[model samples]
Target: MPRSEYVASIRSRIGTDLLLLPGVTAVIRDEDRFLLARHQHSGLWSLIGGAVEPGEEPGEAVIREVFEETAANVRVRRIVGVYGGHPMMVTYPNGDQVGYVTTAYDCELLSPATPDLDELLEVGWFERDEIKTLPRRTWIDRVIDDVPRGSV
Candidate 1:
């Protein structure tokens, strides 16, 4: 998608006025490796997560989204932190805009299975060093570093 189209898509989703919505992001790790997805939207690597639907909690959203995108059953352990995407803007392919407030969590994989790639282009567990090398969004590095070092 072109940059202008992406920006327009984001604008449509968010509208002209900014809106704050609840979102969930999961940091699933095993043996010092974290699960990351290659986002289909912009081709940038990021954690598996999505918007928290009405009447749904952030943790619930993370679990559901992780399963849907990666097919890995996960249990959210704790909320690492909440981050605002105010300074940032996300644009979609259809010219929609989205302003996001993401609740990041430290989670563990409950099922010993590989991820199914429907929403995601690719999925894998990567070490911290490896994560640093991937073409990831700005928020990803902070999310990975904040994982309570040794929590996995």
Candidate 2:
């Protein structure tokens, strides 16, 4: 099936009007740098995360998503912030919408592993100074800014 059709199928299963539901993103840090992923769909870099499955807690979702997307095990250290998925609409390359409510977490990597290249085109650690240069939507900047310094 096409990507849009697949997303629609998933949304239909949720039984909600919102296109996207609750999800988690990990702001993983190793020393002063943060782990980031270059998304396969948008080609824009973002934190590793995905939707929280039905019946699963937000913390559980982040751990599962980090391993699935990046192949790196992580532990949620703190809740960085909860964000409206409305702003970060899951727009496919063709402009299809997949709605979501993202929960951004400050997490710590529990193991060293390479990211799954098929889902994430690039994965690496970026310093705070470099984070400013990454090609990200404005919501990312707002989320990161909300994280208190030295909290991670």
Candidate 3:
């Protein structure tokens, strides 16, 4: 997984110190299905999203991330929740640590797309019940549980 230039620069100065960065998570729902991606870094399925880039709004970050990982365009409908603390802490294989203050959004898919294989192993829509059977981390479970069914 390639770190964003912004994150790379910060890591250059701080090394492996935990950086509390702003991030976003997109919970894109299209009727009975929700979008998910199998992230390369974690090798676990998760909601579509990524870091909130410098100067970008949280909503903008969600849109950018969703497109980058899934090649899917989306409109942020409403915030599902804000999350942080222990569950948001991440330590990469290289030992770089991060604590993300993430804004999870309920989004509406607006265009056709599929998983961007460069960033993800796979991407697909899943029924709510089907999510429990997918490979994921504990935090991923909590994030999915935070989203409401049907619509945001």
Candidate 4:
């Protein structure tokens, strides 16, 4: 999916100034491995998810986002955390500044993915030990470290 229409509209008026937005992140796991997407815009591996649309719940948004970005069907098992403040602030490649109030969830992939190349450079599953070797954003590492090992 593209930068959400709601966010796009907001960006049009705000330019690159910081915008506080509600979003969701999916921490999908398959046995001992976790699914992560290499962001096309950021070039950093991160959890698969996107913004919550108007009237959409964070849990619902994560399921939709996971499917849109990776073509993977998933069920949100539980929320890992509700995070914001400095850790959520980000500057996109186009200089759009956003501070996300993100509700992240642990998810179970119901099937294999057919990744959307426009949104992600690549998508793969990595074991916990292997995650340390990848170039990942702080939030990704934080979510992985924070979530319980046998949740989803």
Which candidate leads in lDDT? 4
Which candidate wins on TM-score? 4
Off by over 4 Å in 2: 1-18
State the lDDT at 115 in candidate 3.
Answer: 79
Q: What CA root-mean-square deviation does each model show from the true structure?
A: 4.9, 3.6, 1.6, 1.5
lDDT, candidate 1, at 3: 30
> TM-score of model 2 relative to the true fold?
0.82
Clashes of each: 11, 3, 0, 0
Candidate 1 Cα misplacement greater than 4 A, ranges: 1-19, 86-88, 113-116
lDDT (Cα atoms) of all candidates against the true structure: 0.74, 0.75, 0.82, 0.84
Pull out the clashing pairs in model 3.
none
State model 3's lDDT. 0.82
lDDT tens string, model 1, 1-152? 22334445655665655545567898888767888888777788888787777777778889988877767798888898888764345766654566678998888888853555445678878898798898987777877777766645
Q: How many clashes would you count in candidate 2?
A: 3
TM-score head-to-head 1 vs 2, winner:
2
Q: Per-residue lDDT tens digits of candidate 2, residues 89-146? A: 7666654466667889988888985868777788888876688898965566767777
lDDT tens digits by residue: candidate 3, 88-150: 898988999989888989888888768787778888888878988988755666777776666
